[model samples]
Target: MDTKSLLIDTATTLFQQKGYKSVGLTEILKACNVTKGALYHHFPNGKEELLITCLHGLNEVITTDIKAIFSRHLSTKDAILSMIDKLILNFEKNDTIIGYTFSSIVSEMATMSEPVRIACSALYENIQNLYHEKLLTEGYSNESASAIALLLTASIEGAIMLCITQNSATPLKTIATLLPSILEVNK
Candidate 1:
C-alpha cells in the first residue's frame, strides 16, 4: 500500500494489539518503517489525528458490512443470526474480529480525547441505526426496535469480548443458539 495507508494500518494494528496510550508515534513510525517527518506530512495533528482517521475508516467499513448483512436477509432475525454465525466463523478462522477492536479503544482512551470519543460514539450509533431501520421494516414498534437494536449491539460486543478472552467462539456460538427466541415478535 501507499505510505499514508501503510502508516494508518500499522498504527491501527498496533493500537489494537497494544493500545493508543501504550503506543507512541515513534513506535508507529518504526512499525511502518516510516520516519517522523513522513507521518507528520500526512497527519499534521499527529497521533490523535491518525487514530481519529483510523476510527472513521473503521466506522465506514464496519457499517457497510452491517448494512450489507441487514440488506441480505428479508427478516431482522435472519440477518442477525447470520451475523452471529459469521462472527463465530470469523473469530475461529482469523482469531480476530476487526470490529471488536473498537471496544478496546473505548476502554483505553474514551476519556482522553474528544474527537476520538465522538468518532467512536458515532460508529456505535450508526450500527444501532442500521439495526433499528431493519427491525422497523419488519413491523416492530419503534420502542421495540430501538431497544432490540441496542440489545443486539451490546450483546454481540459482549459476546465478542468473551470469545476473545476465552480464546474460543463458544460464547458467540451460544449467543447464536439462544438469539432466535429473543428475536421473536412477542419478545
Candidate 2:
C-alpha cells in the first residue's frame, strides 16, 4: 500500500483500539515505520489530520454499506430488520460489537473538537436520512418515519455497546427480535 493509505489504516486500528485522544503520533510513526518527516510530508496537520482521514475512511465504509443494504425496495420494517442483521453479521465477523471506529471516536472527541464533531454528526445524520427515506417509501408519515429512524439508530448503537461490555451477542440478538415489535410491525 501507499504511504498515505498505510498510515491511515494503521492510525484507524490504533484509534479504534485506544481512542482518538489516547493514541499518539509517535506510536503511529513507529507502527508504520515512517519518520516524522515522511508523516508530515503526507499529513501536514499531524495527528488531527490523520484522525480526520481515519474518520472519513470509516464514514465511507459505514455509509456505503448501509446504503447498499437499504437500496433494496423492501418495506420499512423489513429494511430495518435487514439493517439489524447486517450489524449482527458485522459484529460477529469481527468478534466485536462495540469499538466501532467512528462511533467510539465521536463519543470521545465530539465534545472537544469541532471538526471531529461535525464530521461525526454529519455521518450520523446521513445514516438517519437513509433510514427515514426507506420508511417514507414504505408509506409512513415523514415526521414519524424520521423519529423512528433516529430511535432505531440510537437503539442499535446502545445495543452494540451493551453487547460489547458483556462480551456477548445476546443483547444484540434480543434487540433484533424486539425491534420489529417496537416499530409496530406485525412481523
Candidate 3:
C-alpha cells in the first residue's frame, strides 16, 4: 500500500525466493518501483535493515494467522493439523515455501549480523509462544506446554528443511501424519 510497506513486501518475497545475500537493493527497488531515496527514508540502515523489516512483516502475518487458526479450531491438535495442512496445500499449489527460504537466510546471516539473527530468533520465539499458549489451553502444565511447543516448532521446521532439500513434500506429510500421536494432544 504505502512505499515502506511495498518495499517490505517486495523484499520479503524476493528474499524468500532468493537469499538475502544474493538479492541486492537494486532488485528490491525495481520490484517495488521505488527509488533509493524512498528505501533509505524508510530503512536508514540499508539492506540489512530492510531484511529485518521484511522478517518482521512476515512474522506479523504468521502470528496473526496462528491466532486466527487457534481461535477457530478450539483444539490445539486441530489447530496445528490445520496449519500443517495449509502448508501442504500451499506447497502443492505453489511448489515453493517461504519458510525454507527464511531458513536459508537465517543459516547464512545468523553469524554475520546480530540484528538479522535477533529477528530470526524473535520470529521463532513468537511462533513457539503461540504454540505454547495453545498447549496451555489444551490443559497441559506450563513445563509440558513449553516443551511440546518447542518440539513442535523444531519438528515442523526440520520437516520443511528436509522437504526442501529432498525436493519432496513427503517429509512434511509424514510429520503431519505422525504429529497427533507424537504430541499426545488428545491426552
Give the higher-lDDT candidate: 1 or 2: 1
Where model 1 places Cα greater than 4 Å from the true spot, the runs are 185-187
- Looking at model 1, residue 35 earns an lDDT score of 91
Candidate 2 segments exceeding 4 Å error: 98-100, 185-187
Candidate 3 C-alpha error for residue 47, in Å: 0.3
Candidate 2 Cα deviation (angstroms), residue 16: 1.5
**Please, what are the lDDT tens digits per residue for candidate 1 over residues 1-187?**
9999998788878887677889999899888899999999999999999999888888888888888988889998899988888888888888977655678887777888888889889988988999899989999899998999898889888898888879899889888877778889534
lDDT, candidate 2, 1-187, per-residue tens: 9999999999998888778888888999999999999899999988888888888887787777777777773766677678777667767887674335366787898998898888888777877888888777777888888888898788877887776667667777888888888677521
lDDT of each: 0.85, 0.79, 0.86
Q: What ranking of all candidate models by TM-score puts the best one first?
A: 3, 1, 2
Candidate that beats the other on lDDT, 2 or 3, i.e. the better one: 3
Error of 2 at 180 (Å): 1.0
Model 3: runs farther than 4 Å from truth?
Answer: 98-101, 185-187
What's model 1's overall lDDT?
A: 0.85
Q: TM per model?
A: 0.93, 0.88, 0.94
